[model samples]
Target: MTKNHNSQHKDLMLQNSQKLDRLLTRLCKRSGCDEEEEHEGGNESVLFIAAKNGVLEILEKILKDKPGAIHETNSLDQNVLHVTVENRQPRVFEHLEKYLKEKELWESHVARADKDDNTILHLAAKLSRYKPRHIAGSALQMQWEVKWFLFMKKKMPHMQFLQNKSRKTPQDIFVRDHEDLLEQGIGWLKSTSESCSVVAALIAGVAFATATTFPGGTQEETGKPYLERHPAFNLFAFTPLWALFCSITSLITFLSILTSRQQPQDFRKDLPSKLLVGLSYLFMSIASVLASFSSAFFFLLRDHLQQVVFSLYAVAILPIAYFGVAQSPLYMDLMRATFRNIPQSSNRESEKLIL
Candidate 1:
């Protein structure tokens, strides 16, 4: 059986090599033509052939001979690597590994999508027969995952399980036969607890401070009050002191969260990024809450246009806030759970995205 498998692989390799050589000759012949020189189509044909054949040796030589060829994109606005993954050609991935190793391509190799905006992994996960050529085992899989994840994590981490053009996720395609793996992923996310205590505390502080508010010459104004009066969005009513209290509370919560994560030996390393991310989220959330509250108040006061605008703005803020808070795995899990219930919408979005 081993001999037969080896012999088959050898035959396939020879056939592929012969096909690639013929393709190279044809492309070389066309490279000098006026029609080929007129557009990117011919250049793409050459790259597609090289990438599809996993002909890294020839590709490297071409790159060395004409570095400008590396910058070309195909008809669908994809690089050679993108075409390789799109075709589910493992040889292309093998060639890519060698190319990246020699040239540190990650710095220069920007991911371009097809008409559907699908990333390489997005294409791979959808391809049932796709298996990385040179790379093998969990090591290569994990490496690719990390690289792919890092590339798209910020924009759409939840997109892993989300369906794409082919109505599948990389997770779905990769783990189609493994129910346990799917369950494990969902279970891990669901287990992470959501953090709302700080937010609740901040809101409570706002309410308390609002209750303590008094205008000038009032009884509380004579005492040392928590906050002073500021011009409200509505000049008709006295401005609440809640914003000051909420801001202070949120700032304290942010600091506390930062402090808890700090290590004595490596305090500088961890604390700054956490502080920045946390504070940015807190400020944005507080501002949004204030905007929504003001909008609601104005709506009650019959300011229809302002109310509509503010309400729309508030609604738009939810996804952004979700992203800001998604550093908390629990919030992300909640989003996942919520999204799971609306699979039809998710699939629709995926289809639209693929389109």
Candidate 2:
């Protein structure tokens, strides 16, 4: 039933896409102008709308039908690249970039400035009006913004230092525009660090106590643990020390985050990397501490109450499972945002647009 429903949905979308294609073709023919040509008044064209909304299929179709439309600019002198970057449409931008580079028009198109003398780099530096649905937190969002600016900077090296009409360079615009976001990111990082650091500290303290006091009392003569010969002894022996080390490492990492200068550049990699490391160590510590407790419980109850040992193991797993499920999304997001590669235009020829 689920597969059938999904199939039906996909078919519907395909049908809708076909109808849209036909409508666009007819409109282009009737108007006797390309997709980017203005409508009756000064309203934006269909091509501009598609680029802004990241409707890659529509944009691709239009570009294929009328290649010259790629050069047309709106009243504000903003081209397809400007629209895509301002609206945070990475896919569309990538497609257009590849198309332009293939045509050997990359330098000319990328160097175009709008009415305000704001280059594509300047537009990239400005924050988009829409919030990114994929990135969760404000801090991660800031990280993406910085990453995008840097990506555009690399694409147009000469334009990076060029000032706009307001006499502000792209970097200057970025700093001025993202000041509030930077502050919010700092606050978010500090709060997250503070909360996680407390947990790490508590785990460290517990692990230290457990490591000092072995599961079984020591023999008076040899001063060796009575349970040293037992099978679970190795687990009980190793896990607490591992837990202590991991928790201490987690604590230090979080402390670094809390104490970070948190410049805008830090959001690009440094801060997120630290947060990822801290969270990773914290998770390892939790698992290790739970394993130590479970092993100790299993050893104590193995001979007397074997059934209780299984129950103890199950009980020990519950918290770790809960923690994993609860924090998995955040951890995954951080990992992706911290280490994700910037989208690059591919060398392959652009995919043919099906009309």
Best by lDDT: 2
lDDT (Cα, tens digit) per residue for candidate 1, span 210-268: 44543332445557432234344333132234344454555555555434522221121
lDDT values of the candidates?
Answer: 0.47, 0.83
Q: What's the CA error at residue 235 for candidate 1, in Å?
A: 99
lDDT of 2 by residue, 209-284 (tens): 9998877699999999998998888998999999999999999999999887889999999999999999999999
Q: Whole-model lDDT, candidate 2? A: 0.83
Best by TM-score: 2
**Which residue window of length 10 is worst by lDDT in model 1?**
341-350
Off by over 4 Å in 1: 1-43, 89-95, 98-110, 128-169, 172-355
* Span of ten consecutive residues with least summed lDDT in model 2: 345-354
Per-residue error (Å), model 2, residue 206: 0.5
